[model samples]
Target: MPMPDMNLLIALDALLEEGSVVGAARRMHLSPAAMSRTLTRIREALGDPVLVRAGRGLVPTPRALALQAQVRSLVEQANEVFQARDEVDMSLLERRFNVRSNDVFFGAFGGQLVDTLRVHAPLSTLRFAPEGEGDDDALREGRIDLHVTSRRNFGPEIKVQLLFYTRFVALAREDHPIFDAPITPESFVRYDHVSVSRRGRAHGPIDLALEALGLSRRVALTTPNFHSAIFSTASSNLIVSLPETVLWGMRELGLRMRPFVIPLDFEPVQVVQAWHPRCDKDPAHRWLRQTVKQICATVEERNAGVWPQP
Candidate 1:
């Protein structure tokens, strides 16, 4: 079967509403001859002379009268499909957002973020997933709504926004020997270290920084997550280096540990929130990003001293 001309629907709508070829032509900004041709096409397509001469003006045929309301409704609905959505009612929005991040982020601000969402978008749910091996396919596939991390090599197509900056600090048992004297590059390297790496690697930027100072620390233990590193450091002499911001909520856990400044000068870690471009204009996704930013700001304020050093 042949497809019908969609343009004829607009012309038919104008002709029925105006009830005159000249008036319809003016409404559609077309010549009277062109409008007459369009009306002839509409008649042939519908097998009905949709408009007929009634004295000095045109009157709709019974079939055209029956279709006027339906045609108007279809045109109105089509117009709405192309228009921008300008408002969102939060209370009425029900959605689930899956956020992927390291354990440190969840341990720090996950509770606060959930609480904020409960108060603002009561019907929405938040899910946290662990950051697996630096892959971004979850975001591109829409499985993960947001990704929070310090490493930002998610490729050019992914949209990234800086959430906050943090610096590495040494975490050790409260009465560890490192606290007995002033920490220097020489003294800091003397203690055995516990290193955290998601990929199970033993060395990182800390090793490189120490190498530049003609010093090196012994990474006696390797852990995949911050919590394990903290537990290991708290119970033994192993000193662990982690971002200061990650320790935001650790105090509530009653962990017997203290943080001290790392002696070597290293670049600050940039923590960012990334998402796929597919959800850039979605109102619900936009709200999720804004809420994540607000939560990061609140966490930063509560732990002001953890910011990147100059």
Candidate 2:
């Protein structure tokens, strides 16, 4: 038996990804004719028309669809094998990391994160992308290095690690009339409310908890992030419910906001950091992940004694 040409794997992976010979050629820096020849060889090796012409373009065959993820994984692993390093010297490392997270996280620990990275990887850059409301393919597509979120519906190939936990706490202006008395379900519902949801949702666990008690509070405002909701409380009678840890962050900003426990049983938010398995063995990526975990712990420790949390 003739030995199979392992180089065909790269062409096959590129063809399956682009769904067009020209696009694959451009990706591999080859001419269209050369890409076509490579594609023919790949078709013969795999015994499948990996991409078939359809409506002026090409679509993957069922076989190609099944092999897509596997092929990509193999290619990534092969590249890692060739590029593997024994150790990553942080002082000399120069790379940019893209992290996606909500504003609450940025407001609370963004400065510390940047400072820590500057000290460790002086030439490295940290870019923070805003969280999206819809299903995101950023991690799998390699658009972002890390996704810090409470969402757990990521594809099976994504690796996840718990960062920390937080629960909801209500915030109001320092001199709001609500501060005059002990907060209860009834008093908490007396004033209008502000909410933070990336999906523009006007209700959430807070509403369900209120409904359980036969009590309902009107959401007078809905902002797409916690920063807006937190700032809105500074000038209005509206109370905002946000992550408990964010209160300390607000205090550091010298915002005259008062924090009080919401009078309802609520689930703790299990914050997690997710990434693609492609970065699993990359030394620099591993160091970045460890740095994030360390930053979260520092934030958690600094927030202690500031609020009574469960």
Candidate 3:
């Protein structure tokens, strides 16, 4: 057997993308006659009428439709491979990045991130989606550009960088009864609590730690995000345990909330930003990762221990 013409793959991509002989020819800077001959070669090699005549326009066949995304990915990767590493012009970039994150992250750095992008990559658009919206392989399949989260359930091949480490702190109104006395394990469990779990799980390391001490707290409410839990604490006696970073600006946001050290042993949360390995070398994606990392570092440093220790 002989190797197939690799150039035909490019022609096939163009033809499928344009869906017209004249359009593909214009895109590739080729004559319509030459583009038609190339399409014929592509059809012969693939054994399919990749594009069929529809009344005044061309429509992709089922096979072409199925292969459209894969072919586009291949072409893009090939282009990235050949492009210069330092060739990215941020001002001219017109790409959209899909970032999946929880509310805690958005509360911490969303505004700063948007400002940085507007000044640097003005043509780029950042779409921040809530958690649990995409499939398991959303990052791998290129549906999501970045995952700024604490969860580490991604595949081993995914590139991950620790953005920062934050420990859990119980947040409540500054004048709540829990703060009237020393916050001990006994006093901590006396008040109702608000739990933040996307899965609606009310118990976690805090509960287990309390269990080990022969004590457990009642979770009166369970919310899916930290923002809701934080807000719920503002007007109620509910004590909510959240990452220290999430409550950084509670006072400035006019929430009148304060964080106290939980009287229990717990590990620090490793907030990380993850991406597919295919984007490891892509300049724009790399910039996004770096920008996020920088923003996290800046916020952590500026607001280090924003709330007073109780």
Candidate 4:
């Protein structure tokens, strides 16, 4: 088989992303005719009419939409392979990095991560995006530099580093009557609870464990994040099943928690920092990973005794 022109991949990536041959031409500094010819070649090489006219605008076929992200990632990785930077030069590095994570992580370690980055990369800006709808697509498109989540099932190709493991615990106001004594499953199920998740998921691993034991709790309220759940607990008798790490800001967030005496042995939640494997050897991205890993280690160290001391 003859080697296809790799330049076509780069052009197709830009063309499909821009959705306009003229735009892609301007981006690549190529003439419209040259880019159109390149697009024709990409169509032949890929054996698809990748882009087509829709009214007055160019639109991608389903094939082009599917290939857009994959092609861009491949092009970016190929560029890195040919000119990969071996070392990070922080003093002169000026870049903006976007990290996708939940509010729990921001409340716990975003400050420390920002502090560390400020000291070294003076010109670097860090942005945090919440786990909104379609956020994973942002990561796939290279808009998000890093993603931190306890949720697994991110595709196998996403490069992942274990940051830490977190487990769910029951929480309420410090002076709540429940904390005066050992918390039994019966007692836990008696109290009203708050549901937490970006989608306001009313059930979780706790519910499953309870179901196994023929128990269930009343969900009094549903909120999107841990901060809201904890804050709500501070004013109401409503209990919350939250990750142990969210307790880190209890003194600051004004919430407290105690373990159930009839504790269910639930799966440990592994929090990981994930990125596209295309970023694995990129120096700037490597620095970002190390920086985040250090932040996670600091959080773990600072809250050492908080997790179930066993």
Candidate 5:
């Protein structure tokens, strides 16, 4: 079957509304003769003389009357589809955004994120999902809205923006004997350590740094998250290494721990927020991204002197 010209729908709608060919022509900025030809096409397309002569005026046929409401509705919907979405009415926005991030990020900035949303988008909710191997797939499939973590090559398709940069710091119980003496490579390797690894692998950059100095620390315990490692270190002599941002968050939560430099040249980790290309222009998603960026900026400002610059 042949496709009908969509232009005819507009002409038909004008013709039915105006009733007179001259009036419809004026409404569409067309000549009377052009409108008459358009009505002819609409009749041919629909197999009906939608408007017919009635004395000195014209009236719509029963078929045209039946289609009047439907045509107008479709045209209105099409207009909305092409409209600009640069702004959103926050109070009217009722939606749930799923964010995937590690516990450290949540611990550091999640409270601020919630406070911002409460004042701006009161009705919207945030759902933070744990990071996993399927985060890329979840983002592509629309199962997740944003992915926040350390920056890595997520191929070329994912959109990423740097939130902040952080480096690891050694943490231990506040009164540990390590604090009584000057910290050096030798002393750092003397304490039994607690390692935090999501995959449960013991060795990391610290081990490599120690190996360079012909020294190694015993990893007495390995936990999956910074919270567990902090809890373990607070009550025991086991030392743990964690991002400076995570340690700051832990301090805010009243965890008794002390942070010290690792005494090794380690690259700073670039923490970033990532999203799928599909959500690049979504107003709600844009707002969420901006909020996260603002929170990170605040954190950076607050810790200007504490966290060393790269």
Candidate 6:
């Protein structure tokens, strides 16, 4: 017996992906007839007609359709493996990275992230994505490069690491009457509040703490993200709740972030960096994670008063 032509795998993979001789030709910059000949070779190797004519277009046969995703992933991983890091001059690495985070994330830490990256990778760009109801599908599909979030029970396949710990604080503008007087639960409850929760959550540690003492704040405005609450509180009298480590320089920008004692103590929030395990050993991906952590450290230093810097 003789060894098979393994080089045909690439062509087979392309043909399976495109399902059309013309499409594979366009992708590989070959004429349709040449691509057809290449497909004939692929069929000889695979022992199957991968792309069978179906109606006006070609469709993959049973074996080819089953092999589609696996082949694509394998070829992609192989390509990356061969394209190892050479002299990576950050200034020359031009790319747009998408990040999935909520309003509080961008308002609090995004500035530091941008500043840090710009000082080194000046050619890079950022796309801040919107937070939705549940798992970030963008991360799975490679649409998002980084995910800044708190620790939550996602599936085991997802990888995560702790970045920092943050504590909650209530925010009110400078010269707000609450700051001038005693902040009892009753006093706090009397004021209307602006708040955020991804699930449209009606309550939190603050609400629980207040309930323990038989009191509650009137949450006049409810939004899906911390950023939404921040912008709303900037001009209104509504009190905003936030994690101090993330919300930077808000007071100087005319939003006073102040500390208030909830009736009961609650745990400090843990800031985490999460990504698909597929990026585990990637050098550039690791570099991005480290850079983000460094920026978090710098921002945490400024928020030391709110919580002990981690």
Highest-scoring model, TM-score = 4
Model 1 worst lDDT window (10 residues): 301-310
Candidate 4, residues 1-310: lDDT per residue as tens digits?
9987888888988898788999999999999999999988988888898999899999899988887877887887788777876897887888999998998899888888889888989889999988887556676789899999886778767888899887677777767778776777878888899999778679988889899999998998998887777778877888888777776766654345543333676797899998987778888889999988877886556666565464
Q: What local lDDT score does residue 42 receive in model 5, on the 0 to 100 scale?
A: 92
Question: Lowest-lDDT window of 10 residues in candidate 6?
Answer: 255-264
Q: Each candidate's TM vs. the true structure?
A: 0.71, 0.80, 0.78, 0.82, 0.70, 0.74
Candidate 2 lDDT, tens digit per residue, 114-213?
A: 9988898999999999987664778876778999988899999899999999888888998999989888999999999997887889999999999999
**Residues 9-41, candidate 1, lDDT per residue (tens digit)?**
989988988899999999999999999999999
Q: Write the per-residue lDDT of candidate 6 for residues 1-310, one digit (tens) a residue.
A: 8986656677777787677788888888889999889889888877888888878998888988777756766676787788766446777778777778776677777877788678878998877886676555556545577788884665677788888887787776656788777777677777798768878776788887787788788889888767668777766778877787545655455545444544356788888878877666766677788887877776556775553233
Show where candidate 2 strays beyond 4 Å: 1-4, 12-67, 133-141, 155-158, 251-255, 304-310
Cand. 1 TM to true fold: 0.71
Residue 156's C-alpha lDDT in candidate 6? 71
* Model 5 lDDT-worst window of ten: 301-310
Between 2 and 5, whose lDDT is larger? 2
Pairs clashing within candidate 2:
none
Give me the candidate number with maximum lDDT: 3
Candidate 3, residue 271: the lDDT equals 91
Q: What is the full ranking by TM-score, best candidate first?
A: 4, 2, 3, 6, 1, 5
lDDT (CA) per prediction: 0.85, 0.87, 0.88, 0.82, 0.83, 0.73
- Screening candidate 6 with a backbone cut-off below 3 angstroms (N, C-alpha, C), the clashing residue pairs are none
**Candidate 5: segments with Cα more than 4 A from true spot:** 1-84, 304-310
Better of 1 and 3 by TM-score: 3
Off by over 4 Å in 6: 1-72, 85-87, 255-263, 304-310
Candidate 3, residues 1-310, lDDT tens digits: the string is: 9998888888998998788999999999999999999999999998999999999999999999888878877877888778748659999999898999998888888889999999999999989988884477778667789999988988998989999888898888978998788889999999999989988999999999999999999999999998888888899999999988777667678878778889999788899999988888888988999999989987567556586754
